[model samples]
Target: MIRDIDVVVIGGGQAGLAAGYHLRRRGLDFVVLDAQASPGGAWQQAWDSLNLFSPAAYSSLPGRVMPGQPGETYPDARHVVDYLTDYEQRYDLPVVRPVRVEAVHPDGDRLRVGTDTGIWRARAVISATGTWWRPFLPAVPGRTAFGGAQLHTVGYRRPADLAGQKVVVVGGGNSGAQIAADLVHATDLTWVTQRPTRFLADSVDGRALFDHATARRRALDEGSADTGGVASLGDIVVVPPVREARDAGLLKAQPMFRRLTATGVEWADGTRAEADTIIWCTGFRPALSHLAPLGLRGPRGHIPTAGTQALEEPRLHLLGYGDWTGPASATLIGVGRPARDAATAIVELLSLP
Candidate 1:
């Protein structure tokens, strides 16, 4: 059966939830389509030891704040999952789950969202599909021939899987560092990165970094120079666990390997290291495959957007894909504003005569 709505939100993660809040406020006839069987979105797939870099108070979606457990400074993945599930129920948002979106096509004056279960015809579409599904593995030589087990950060669950083996954790991002630290307890681990990983000061956390980014963005918008010495949020925050690992001398990182050998990896300096497994903490690309039918994606595989509205397809808006969609839209705290704006814009567009 074909369902008609004023707006269709694809992907019911933090971004989608934020959008849902605003859409509900406007009393729009919208529905959120989530591919996951349950709630929590990408948080369900994060590593077992993964924790938010910010405190619970600072990490939240629109309307409601995430409640943190007593004595817990940072919330873990499971906590986030539970919070998201609760948030969905609290708002009574119209969400249809486990229905994977197949494609989004322009249908004359409206957009047609094709899913595995049915079709949703809407005047506007919001693509909030974040980057968790599309794990990007760099094109390393001999990668296909590697004999050892190789897994991306998404596939990683626990450290016991690599117990008593030589493991190489690639990428200098927070995931790479955290995974390598966790694996050090159960395996001989090596950290590899394309460039040196910068660690934020111990006093700084995800909240501070987010605030700095917000300030910078505001400064840019106001046409003023930002004099703050703050760096990008991509820099690793010295979370307690990571700090402990570093203090224990288990956080040293090596330059990236030249290529993967059948048995292990080869360094650029003619050095070879044998490994039983390789854990790639390399980042992710946008999960925008369903939008392929639109033919609006640029060379970087992202649809150009002006504050959440798609440049080519104005009826479509994108959220939580990263800064390209909106400043800090990928973060829980940052997704709210853009989502609200997108909701308002959709309402205005649909009301046009």
Candidate 2:
């Protein structure tokens, strides 16, 4: 059976929910198709200890503020899950769950969204799948030959899982830092980075990064000199756990290894370290396989988009991927503006002719 709608939102994560709110407010006939079975999208998949860079109040959706936790300064993953579940019910957004969209292609003037269950023919398609599904592992020689267990950050649940084992944590992003801090006391930890990890000023957090992003966007709009946003600040934020770990000299990092050996990894100078496990925090690419039918993606995995709207296919808008999609569009708070703009654009597009 084919259901006709004004818009089809892919991925019911933070970005999709935000877009759904705006679309509902705009009176658009739309439905959100989520691959996941339940609410809280990627937050449910995050590490148990993971918390927002900012406080709950600053890390909220479009309509409701994420109420602060009873004793925690920054809410954990579970709190975020509860908040998203609540927000979905609060707004009464139309969401169809456990629906995995297979492909999206143009069907005459509209888009035909093919999924596991059925087809949704829509005037517009919003791809907000986000990056959680596509965890990236950097290309390295002998990676396949490594004897020890290797897992991405997605597979890591807790430090105790690797307690007393020689584990190497790789990548220089916030995930790398956090996971290393998590494993320091529990495991025999070795932190490796592509480069020396740079921590944002102790005071800087999501709020500060959002400010940079906003300022950078305004500069571009006004045709002024480019002001680098979050990218300019550096790699990781000094969250409480990270700060405490670093102050105790537990979060120190080493340069990345040249290649992986069967037993361990080797540096260019032939320094080798044996490891029982390697946890990669290398980051993720956009989850955009379903868009391959559109034949619009550039060399980079990202579809070239102008403020969430795909340049190649105007009817297709890509949200919550990263800064390329919109300034700070991937963050919980940052996604709201792009979501609103995407919803408004679709409404205008649908209303024409």
Candidate 3:
């Protein structure tokens, strides 16, 4: 049987929960479709010791605030997950948990969402599946034939797994730094980097970097896109790579990997770095393989949703997009606004003839 809903949200993370809650307030008939067992996407996948740097005040959804520690610096990963779960139950959002969506395509005036559970028809769709849906690994020689324990940063949860082992982390991003910092005291670790990273400082005293980035995004939006161009787009918070690795005495300031070896990684200047494990912190890809037929992705598989007031798909809107800035371009704190706007847009589409 084809069940019909006014809107079908494909994700159940903070973004999706926020969108779903708002959609209900807008009086639109909607159902949330989530692949996970419950809400909280990245929070569930992040390291055990991880916490949001943006404090509790800015992390709230449309109408709710994080339950505790509103004046605190940030909440840990587990707290975030707990909050999302509460948000769903509080709003009575119709979330179909653990329903894997196989494909979604446009049907005459609505979108046909096919899942293992059943087929759902929605007049509009809010794609809050986040930009970090897929983990991106670099293609390095001998990567497959490596004789060591290799894992993506996503799979890493605690330093206990890496304790007492010589671990070499690939990529100089924030994730890599955090993992290395966590494991340094318990294990022998080395961090690898080929590209220079921009290091944005952690919030000073109680001030958050998120506030700084928000202002920067607004300033960048002032210029005309006709002359400014999307190429000029950059992140609101650019954290330099050098500062993050500064504390890793042996691990700090290492040159980028030239190639991967059976035993370890090799630097560009012919230096060989040996380790027992390799953790790739390369970053993530957008979750849109099911929507490949839409042909909406831009360079390097990124969904280009900036500058445009709304997405090209009248029924579909991309969230957590844009390399530079928007309502919610690339951070957890930035996700709410886009979720609100997208939900409103979706509700409007559903109400129309």
Candidate 4:
């Protein structure tokens, strides 16, 4: 049966849930389709020790707040998963699980969303598919010939996996720092970044970073003349564990290696270090392959969006990909405003008389 809907949100992550919240508030009929059998989006796949840089108060979606457990400052992956599950049940959002969306194509004035289960015709489509599924690995010379075990951040789960092994953690981002911090106690670890890593002050956390970003975004939006330095979310927040690791002389990161050797990595000065495992925390690209049939993606594999609405396809709205789609749209705290705007836009488009 070809089901019809006012809107079809192509994810059940934080962004999708927020969009569903606003859509429900607007009294619009919508369905959120999730690829995962369970909730929590990509958080379900994060490392066991992974915790949000932000406190629970700052890491929440729309409507309800993320309640922190007693004495727990930052919520971990499992906490987030439980919150997401509860959020869905609380709002009663129409989310179909384990339904993989294969493609979205134009069908007259509507979009035909082809899924593994069945086809759905929607007046508007909101693509909230986050970037976790697409892990990026840099192209280093001799990478293919390396005999050591190599894994991306997506494949990493715990430190015990590389216990007693000489491990190399690559990338300068928060994930790289945190993972290296966690693995340093479990293994002999080396950290590699393209440049020197910048660690934020111990007092500064994800909440503070979000505030700074929000202020910067507001200034830009309001056409203000502020040219002061604005801290980005990419700046490593010295979380308790990471700070402890640094205090213990374990958070050192070296410049990127020149190339990978058969046994390990080689530096520009011809220095070679033997390693048993390499963890690449290079990051991820947006999961937009399902929208390829629409031919909306540009050379950079991104859809040109005007405040979350696709410039190429008006009925298609993209959410939670990153700053291009919306300011801080990829984070839990950042996704709500954009999701609300997206839902409002979808409703306005569908309500056209």
Query: Candidate 3 overall Cα lDDT vs. reference?
Result: 0.69
How would you encode candidate 2's per-residue C-alpha lDDT over 233-259 as one tens digit per residue? 999998888999999998899999999
lDDT by residue for model 4 over 97-202, one digit each (tens)? 9999999999998999999999999999999999999988888998998998999999999988889999999998889998999998889899999988888878
TM-score of each: 0.97, 0.99, 0.86, 0.97
> Against the true structure, whose TM-score is highest?
2
Model 4 / residue 175 / CA error / Å: 0.3
**lDDT tens digits, residue span 34-100, model 3:** 8888677767888887766556766777688776655444677888888888888999989888988
Kindly report which residue stretches of model 2 are placed more than 4 angstroms away from their true locations once superposed.
none
Q: What would the per-residue lDDT of candidate 1 be over residues 1-353, giving only the tens digit for each residue?
A: 89888999999999999999999999999999999999999999988989998899899998899998567899999999999999999999999999899999988888999999999999999999899999999999999989989999999999887799999999888888888888888998889999988988888887787677677777877989864525553468788888999998879999999999999999989899899999999999999999999999897888888889998888999999887777678999989989999998998899898
Candidate 2, residue 163: the lDDT equals 85
Worst 10 contiguous positions by lDDT, candidate 3 = 229-238
Model 4: residues >4 Å from true position, as ranges? 225-234
Better of 1 and 2 by lDDT: 2
How far out, in Å, is residue 277 in model 2? 0.4
Which residues of candidate 1, in runs, are more than 4 Å off? 225-234
